[model samples]
Target chain A: MTYRTGTEAFIQGVRTLIPLTPGVIPFGLVTGVMAIEMGMSPGMSMGMTVLFYSGSAQLVALQLLQNGAVPVAVVVTALIINLRFIMYSASLAPYLHHLPRRWTWPVSYMLSDQSYALCAVKFSSGELGRFAPHFYAGTAGAMWLTWQLSVLAGVYLGASIPQTWSLSFAVPLSFLALLVPNIRGAASLGAAVVGGLIAVFAVTLPYNLGLVTASVGGVIAGLLIESIRKKALSNASTNDVEREAQ
Target chain B: MSDLSLWGMFLAVGIGTFVMRLSFVEIYGRWRIPTLLSRALVYVPPSVLASLVLPAVVYPHGQGAFVFDNPQIPAAIVAAWIAWKTRSTVLTLALGMAVLWGVKVIAS
Candidate 1:
């Protein structure tokens, strides 16, 4: 548990994320394969996998491209879809504050759901020290390497796969897999219903703007419902306390 | 999409995503984010994920564009249930893809 060397922390980080790679490889391959099916050049797809390093946003952009969306819409939708990274950044900021720009920026480039979730817990537990950044970088770098290789294989294999199998269907299927685990709260349900409704009705809009609109609407609905539900629960508790006091 | 436009989209997304990921850590590493923004950020996952997943499941094409009675709808519902029940990404992908291919073959 005492990680003295950066290499030790790095190894520890890589080990921590090993369990999660099973999930990452499939999703990464799917994104790569989908990019090819959706009309992306192999180079662009690979570049995207490298530059963006975000499976969800890359998939969203490819989907938008397939619909002949304008660049603005494609980029905007992808960024919005990736907005969670901001929160991850905020949470990890304190842990990274000690590092200088040269160290922090490169490490920041490696920030991801796995790295953030894993390192955040490590830092919060008051366990890691100066080596936290190296640990995070190690995890991120490992994930990045695995991700790039998977996507390359996927793009190449996706080209050889026959059209009759309809492999492109995996795109939505992967998304369904992502969505199902997240659908727990009233907020999520409300967001899905509202967003789905809007998406269905707004499909005809130019630039694939409907997707962005639905996403924004869904976020609003979820937040609104969540706040209201929380207020109601708090009020109910207060009322019970008042009755007891009386 | 033109090469220029495609590359432009890539640059925009790549830069935007990086900026977002780096922002709090590099730019505002010392700043304390407001409680409200953090709370709202929690809802982003569900909302954006639903927005992305639903249309693909419901339409299976660019909104109202369908050929040969979309099989994805039923497949998605089954996959969704499995996703909720198991919460394993691999399982969900397997079941979802199987159902989709299964529906397509049976319908044909």
Candidate 2:
């Protein structure tokens, strides 16, 4: 499928990002506040905004740091939490592999949730070409700049904002926003529920290993349920075919 | 721990994260991921998210007690409802902050 026009595609990509910004801006703000509370300077926070560019991992790292967890532990937790991005990046490789090395690094830096989603859709529609890279680059690049600016602004405001406000809630709220749309399948829902239950039971684990267990348990349960459901459906279908033959 | 060696640790985590992000694309560029690995990756987001949010909202302090003494629990419930109802991240956040602020005031 051919994209209509280069300019139109870029415009459309930017438009796609508009709806996502509302969720992203508040997350950026929360990250900024958490950074300050965790004893990070604005510069360090800005660095995080530019380098990591992940809301979930950054929030986890902030909490860990605030608790005085060892740096190694903080690093490890952040790594594990963000391990999903590797999948996202790998999935997009076919779309992005054509770009020059100079552009690749920057594109990789801008590969957040919104960018990945938008780029994945665009790439699948056979839109990889000269300006396609720029379309994604512009859209994601715009998001990255806006994210850092929001965080920087929040860091400044964080000093004045009272501790009672609890800007940290913004983090989960952002995730909640994303999670709602993705909960379309029963398997995914079951996984989430079972995962939540396991997490509650294992809340006392140090450095949040409980998170890993909950995640693993939920996935296993969901896979099991899905397998059973698929088997039942296939058996039913087979029975119908046999009845027709008879 | 060591006087918040801000820059040093920042550099370490930043580089580590960047390297990790780049690693998958670099290694798997030529090969497709196996089916089992694909299935496993599917559960990472929700499970990790649930794990992150559950402990914080339910038993935030790492203690074994499961009481709703903290305002985070009620606030999170209210926030989740608003998020589900409106599907508006901005609204969810605004309402959540308001709920948290109200709960904090009452509790304090």
TM-score of each: 0.92, 0.86
Q: What is the TM-score of chain A in candidate 1?
A: 0.91
Best by TM-score: 1
All DockQ scores = 0.58, 0.46
Worst ten in a row by lDDT for model 2 chain A: A237-246
lDDT of 1 at B82: 84
- Which lDDT tens digits does candidate 1 get at residues B9-96? 7888888989999888876645777776776666667777777777777776566675558788887888788888877778878888
Q: Give me the displacement of residue B33 in model 2, in angstroms.
A: 1.1
Instruction: Report iRMS (Å) of candidate 1.
Output: 4.7
Instruction: Judge the docking of candidate 2 as incorrect, acceptable, medium or high.
Output: acceptable
> DockQ for model 2?
0.46
| Top-DockQ structure, candidate number | 1
Screening candidate 2 with a backbone cut-off below 3 angstroms (N, C-alpha, C), the clashing residue pairs are none
